[model samples]
Target: MNEPEAGAAPEEASTGAASAPSGLSRRGLLGLAIGGGVAGLAVGAGAGLTGGVAIGRARAAEDAHSAYEFFGAHQAGITTPVQDHLHFASFDMMPRTDREDLISLLQDWSYAASRMVQGLEVSATGAVGGPAEAPPDDTGEALGLPAAGLTLTFGFGPGLFENEDGDRYGIAAQRPAGLERLPAFLGDDLDPQTSHGDLCIQACADDPQVAVHAIRNLSRIAFGRARLRWSQLGFGKTSRTTAAQATPRNLFGFKDGTANILADDTEALADHVWVSSNDEPAWLAGGSYLVARKIAMLIETWDRVRLSEQDNIIGRDKGEGAPLSGGDEFTAPVFDSTAIDANSHVSLAHPDQNDGIRILRRGYNYVDGNNALGRLDAGLFFLSYQRDPAQFISLQRRLSTDLMNEYIRHVGSGIWAVPAGAEPGSFVGEALFA
Candidate 1:
């Protein structure tokens, strides 16, 4: 996708004498008046502001052709120990009158899924690494969504569809190594490339049965609302498993989301993830951004490596997100000699060099059991959010051939442009194309 021109405006004059109210020029004002008058006529005809807003929003929504939502979880403190868990879900939709219905279905599914997992001690955080800013309220409760014990994230693609294909969305769920996969209704014949929508859900509980039960129940609710096009099921190490025995740390068994920017730190958050837009409609000014990627991992092949090699490839210890160069989880990674050793971090391995690839990654590690060859079915439901996808793509492409590439694949991908929240009585996407 072509990078959008930076929305930055020219600097304003400093002196009072030079400063003047930059009102619309005569022609511009005339245009506004004419447009408003026409809009008034539409309103007078009973079309209402909703229609006007929807029309405007439709113009804007045209930019968000592809999108995705990602969710994941981990254990908190010393809670349950037998299983580690995570989950992901994604959907792609065609932009039509049905778009609203699809969004409603997802909203309902999210609400229902949260209810099913209520009381489970799972960790979740949304939009871990992406350019998009954090929602005004981190709790997500205002949107009628639950606060994940670990993390939950939403990303928007550059456009809803490619050449009139359709809008697309993605989901990632993390759970224990043996948790059940999403049902056939959600995963049957899913196409990584052409499939327009995707959804994933996963959970972990003390009992494998409980995890399966929660997942199956949530699947029914989601599938009941929207037709499933394609899907996959897998398992991975959970926070509950002993650190030494957990396989595929972060599901890729290498430090995942290593470059994820911190959300709580004001300066860092503003620089790495959030987008500020004074020109944007009032409803969207403080809102964050979103970026979604449908990344596929080659887990069966990755599992063949020795533990030490895996650590080198991922630049972190498999058991924890610690830097291979040494540090605790969440500590700033030291990209020094050891980390950049030709045999280790390699020139292409350092994430900082990959400009335009900036985001907060909040995703799930999944495993789908061994295949006929007995190889483990493992990969990442990779979801990332950023103020823009253009920036994130630069980083992802570098990783395409990085040592990690041998263990991962990018079979499917798309982009979406998400807008900020809507006012009361207004539906999402009403701002640009009512």
Candidate 2:
């Protein structure tokens, strides 16, 4: 299908008479029209348009094109308010039996999912090297055997996953960041301890409904071929502000992702995220990177501490993600300064101990307990995509010794090698170990 143009401005819903609905609110009716039209498009595409071939094909093409545009617009809209951040983790797998069967199932699932979500699409790319090294870029030219197994991932954007009342979680808008950042993020983090198996799929659809539907459908389709592992974390105000400004922030409430390298343009993506090589294989170039982390939140213990004390430990205002030393989200943290008479960088504070370790953190905050507890039960599920994982590990280890360690835990973790997109009929990992 069609891919959304990266960074396109969102389209304003028309306010004129032709664009208005008959009886319902314009926005409500528009939501129904888009959702219903997408469902019908998927069903028609899957059945091969036997009943209304011409109509089905036309509608499908039109919807596919519009979906991408919708995604761009949706991203722009949500980025403004910085509502919520959804963090996702996925692992690659090796098929135990019947490679061809596995491929068939995966393809079927991909097609089905593409139809389910607005602006959803799938493509194959080259795989990364072992856990410790960077991925090669000669993805298109090198032809390898089909992957033994594949596991895909999808994450939602802010506010789009909510219901009509904005209270419950539901799929509403499209937030396609697939083309924007996921490939490189996957490749740089793949490794043996973290690597799940053979093939990996990383996806970011326009909205939560699309992401949830796509992943579940894909999982059902690949049930026999591979096992799926998944988790999601939601972001509060802190992480969202950092992301909207294209910077990274951490759970400890520090301006964490400040040093990240930007990939604002396609050319920059090739230089920063994708891999290219002549010595290895011609087809492996243009492949990107992957990185994964399973971070545990230390909610139970953190709750014991007073709010002011907790804020002091994290180095930022609990509400706005601003530094305790004082500044807005994107402003440079006064690492050497202090808000209170007490030192800002305490001897064992998270930011103080880890002086130089930096990674691009895209995390989600979650609340799991009941309201009776008299407090919000939440912590960050952290995910960082980088050209390497070593720096990330070092940063965590440093935090492990700091005071924050008492409140946080590293419960689950894994890494995977993500491949770049390839031409049609070419499955992921068709280059390295064919």
Candidate 3:
């Protein structure tokens, strides 16, 4: 659920006329390394998102492998068990590429994604078989590793439908009314370099290597059609989507998402998370909207605050994670209690305070080294999904005065209209192309 923004480049499909010989098997899996094993690439500037750690030819993407199906009514990651790691890449499409190029890229991307999610190589020819002197078809780093429950999701930003230059992909007419650019919010300190993207791919898996491998291969297949804009690697989920999973803590060390919407709540999903065919543009039937915010935490300052004040700002107990007014973690907070501050996080973000509106939060904890001042450069990479973008917008507007704002700043933001999953015979954005 955590993410970054990016653009792309691609590798041509293999001819299938060639197959790897014995001894070349696992080395072929190393073919999956991000940036195709290149260094100081993929993300730009401050992020330095390059580290193509090669997984030697001795390993294969098969050892403890377990896979999730690629074809479904809705994408898998949205409701799937929250994964351990996320490799999010955002991309800006190539200039004047036209609709055909976009379509072809989607076709190719879907093919590669479908195969990779199933623990198969991206190309029919695998990594070792290709033009002898040219680059290998597959990168090979993911070789010998289990599939690790990997899921890949695709999304289109407002720019993808119509950029400043007009509808470059000839997709302006099909843009859903709900896909507008997000409005600037209070306390926003967004960095343009890591902010929005024309498109995005979110890869999640239990294994970090498997997650990075997914994004790397897809970015490789996207060459010529797109370029990387920004990317983010996130760990330690800050939210839970199921009852079986224990509630996890954020950097603030509070049990987060204790009252979140569970994945199995079909009623709640239909009412708030998924978009139905009757909604708009018609093409987004089973899809949803994704909002990403890179919130930077002022941890040093937060740590300096008294423990009781910290709990007061959060509206929950430091150890129990219970609402300040009483009860257990999942117990409803007594919002009306005199002990509860009106501006506290839970008080302001509560569904009751927002007209029963709620968004599915899938945030992750991130630590990107240290800032120039040498303090922790980290915060919550906030990710949420809702049927209507306004649902999130309205709720956020209500939280504009939250007491937690003193310790966090929104440094990155993006909103993407997640297209529904590809059916067996189609690509991810097939409906839009139609």
Root-mean-square deviation of each candidate, in angstroms?
19.2, 17.8, 7.2
Best by lDDT: 3
At residue 303, give the lDDT of candidate 2.
60
Order of candidate numbers by TM-score, starting with the best: 3, 2, 1
The lowest-lDDT stretch of 10 consecutive residues in candidate 2 is: 1-10
**Residue 155 alpha-carbon offset, candidate 3, angstroms:** 0.3
lDDT of 3 at 387: 87
TM-score of each: 0.50, 0.51, 0.87
Write candidate 3's Cα lDDT for 140-183 as tens digits.
77777666767888999989998777887887999988788789
Kindly report the root-mean-square deviation of model 2 from the true structure over all alpha carbons: 17.8
Candidate with maximal TM-score: 3
- Relative to the true structure, how large is the alpha-carbon lDDT of every model? 0.35, 0.34, 0.74
Q: Where does candidate 1 stray beyond 4 Å? A: 1-87, 92-226, 231-248, 278-304, 317-339, 342-351, 355-357, 421-427
Q: How would you encode candidate 1's per-residue C-alpha lDDT over 168-265 as one tens digit per residue? A: 22111111111122222211233454233433332432222233333433333333233333333223332221222232245554544334443333
Better-scoring candidate (lDDT), 2 or 3:
3
Clashes of each: 88, 42, 35
Which stretches of model 2 miss by more than 4 angstroms? 1-95, 98-206, 230-289, 336-358, 368-378, 424-427
